[model samples]
Target: MTEPLIELKGVSKSFGSHKVLDNVDLTIYRGEALGIIGPSGTGKSTILRIMAGLLAPDEGEIYVQGVRRDGLIEDGGDPVGIGMVFQQAALFDSLTVEENVGFLLYQNSKLPRSRIRELVKEKLEMVGLPGITNLYPAELSGGMRKRVSFARAIMSNPDNPSETPEVLLYDEPTAGLDPIASTVIEDLIRYLQSAQGVCGTYAVVTHQDSTIRRTSDRLVFLYEGKVQWQGTVSEIDSTEHPLIRQFISGNVHGPIQVAG
Candidate 1:
């Protein structure tokens, strides 16, 4: 069998008094779309941060492509091009959408200004937000800003043509949007994962049932800072796992408790 693309072994993280993750072990394979789902604030976002090397676990280790490393994984260039679409869109209000999308290429890539702009425009069109390059983040709707963020995450570095980020990590891509906007983002996620062959592997951290059902082939449930269940999207309904059942049904009377 081929080695997994990413491995989290006995990973644990805490924020002062709050324990955010504990002994979280997850393995993500090549060319697969995986969703991490759970109740709100169950450390789903924190897990993405750890995976992106934004935060380090106090215990355990992170191994990329079966190699143990001290810092973020890097091969030919920048930290393995781990693209993360942040939960809040995280766009720069001062920059135009085009600038924000091509910021990395502008800074590190040897590609000319015109060529970089072309690439950024192409990515924007791919995300279904064509010809909005001149607008600022504040000028667009929430869903549009989120889509621009998606475009940024997938942009490759010209300096390291062979070093494009193989992994795309999304943290709540559909949160805080209306039903229609949420559907658009979910569909885009599926398109990028399945059609474009953009990234070798991608992981989504989300709470929406539609997102999990539509975008991922398999999923893992994170609860109380640890993964409690893992299964295919189809198995989610028939599983006897109490945590998963409560989560999917959004039940308040099960083993899982609603925070007051």
Candidate 2:
């Protein structure tokens, strides 16, 4: 296997008295689609936030490209860039699509306005959302908003190409979309991985079955704060691991306890 792009060693997290993650170790390799899945409240999103450096783990270390990070992403830089597409698409309600996607460059980079606009156009087109630069978030449907967020995630500063995200973290990207919309997002996810060089490795946190099966090459099943199972997409069907079977079959009687 390729060297890991991100590694969480002995990671643990908690909210007040409730433990979300417990001494969990996980790795994301270069150029792989990893799916993180489990029952609601099993800490799937918590792990993604830790890996993306958005949240600090209370009891473990995070290494980016094998270099230990001292603090949150705001505190310092990682060896490689990591970007996240939030579950809600997280766009600015007041900004136009172009402004939302190009916000970083506009605020931080020295590039000319024309150049920034050009780059924004490129990214928008890359995500199959062309000519909507003037539209506001309210003008788009749920799926379109998600795609715009994707464009924003992959958006990078040209002066510092190294800052471009090599690993993308997606949190419930297809959550509320219809089946057709979900498939579109799934296809776009795979397309971004295979064709686009910016985001070669990605980890998606999703509950939608099709999103899990179609977007992920390898699967990590989390339950009770630990990785209960790990296997490939194909193995999901043949493996008889109780947790895997229960999850794939949507069975309420297996080892996994259904939440009320």
Candidate 3:
């Protein structure tokens, strides 16, 4: 069997005394899409942060392409190859789309300004926002901002040319968009996986059922700081797990408690 592109073993994290992730183990294979679904505050986003090396787990280990991740950059475990798309788009208000997409290249790469502009245009076109390089983030719609963020995440190549990022971490990619825009983001997610063929694997954290169903080849359900159930999207509809049933049906009762 092929080794997983990303793996988490007995991962546990806590914010003060509140335990968020408890002994979580997950594996993401190359060329596969993994969807993570859970109620709010269930550590779904925390998982993404940990995988991206943005936050360290109090316990357990994370391995990217078989390399163990530990400590800060000075200690040698820097967030080198990983690409992250935040939930809010997180674009710079002062910079134009071109600057936003090429921000990493400008900061990290020693490439000339002219070459960087050419590369930025190529990436913008890849995300379907070609010719809008001069537009500021405030000028574009919500969907367009998310696409710009997407373009930025993929702007850099890591040291290992053959293992470029290999993993894409997405936190709520479809949130705050209308139905039409949500669908567009969903299609773009799939397109990135199919067309670029560079990300190699991805893990998406979302609560939207349609987004989950349309994008995931595998599903993981989290609750009360741990995974409650896991299976394929097709298997989700047939699941007998009460938490899965309640979440999928949008039921207020059953295994999930809505706090007052």
How do these models rank on lDDT, best leading? 2, 1, 3
Give the Cα error of residue 77 in candidate 3, in Å.
5.4
**Clash count list over all predictions:** 0, 0, 0
Q: Write the per-residue lDDT of candidate 3 for residues 1-260, one digit (tens) a residue.
A: 46677788999999988999999998888778999999999999999988887888899988877888776323564433678899999999999898889887777777788888987898788888989999999899999999999888877533335424567888999999998999989998888887754575788999988899888889989898888898999998897989999999999988788988
Error in Å for residue 63 of model 1:
0.8
Among these predictions, the greatest lDDT belongs to 2
lDDT of 1 at 94: 97
Using all chains and alpha carbons, the TM-scores for the candidates as numbered come to 0.94, 0.98, 0.94
Error of 3 at 39 (Å): 0.4
Tens digit per residue, CA lDDT, model 1, 81-152: 578999999999999999999998888777899999998998998899999999999999999999999999
RMSD of each: 2.0, 0.8, 1.9
Give the number of the best model, judged by TM-score.
Answer: 2
Candidate 2 residue 201 C-alpha distance from true site, Å: 0.6
True-structure lDDT of candidate 2: 0.93
Clashes of 2: 0
For model 2, what is the alpha-carbon lDDT of residue 201?
94
Tell me the spans in candidate 1 whose CA falls farther than 4 Å from its real position: 72-80
